[model samples]
Target: MLLHESQLAQGVFNLTWKVEMSGTIETGHVKWFNDEKGYGFISRDNGQDDVFVHFRSINSTANRKTLQEGQRVEFKVIKGPKGLQAEEVTAI
Candidate 1:
């Protein structure tokens, strides 16, 4: 089946899948982070919009990982309650 057709089928059945049909995985820079609050915003290089990122979404191998301002990162944008939020964030 074609890609869009398959997606339409899934939508009809309410069967969600891990697919990149909507938004894209993008690269950006950490605009700022509040370690105390554990939340930050990323400046998207695509120039679409700034995405909200929480420390919990960060992918790190270290015991203590914190994002620094102006750090390059990669992430996927997902729909959040407030709007678009960043997920699976990682330092580049």
Candidate 2:
């Protein structure tokens, strides 16, 4: 995200820079998940906004891919249509 500084010196000024990379891997815990619905949100360890997670994004070897509440996981963050989403999620 780009951050702006509006107050600098006597005149208004703006400064911005990239605070995070687009493909950074993040660690978090499953805030809530619905096995039937196949979707959930993760509470990021870094304290950023929770990231949306879909069943298809999980890395699993079993027949069913699901996450439990408060389950630890690692994944890459990406910009989804609605907002930040978790991809390649793996239980850790």
Worst 10 residues of 2 by lDDT: 10-19
TM-score of every model? 0.74, 0.75
lDDT of 1 by residue, 32-92 (tens): 9999899989999989889889887899998866899999999998766566778899999
Off by over 4 Å in 1: 1-23
Q: Write the per-residue lDDT of candidate 2 for residues 51-72, one digit (tens) a residue.
A: 8899998999999999999999
Candidate 1 lowest-lDDT run of ten: 13-22
lDDT of model 1 at residue 16?
39
What do the candidate models score in CA lDDT, each in turn?
0.83, 0.83
Q: Top model by TM-score, which number?
A: 2
lDDT of 2 at 11: 31
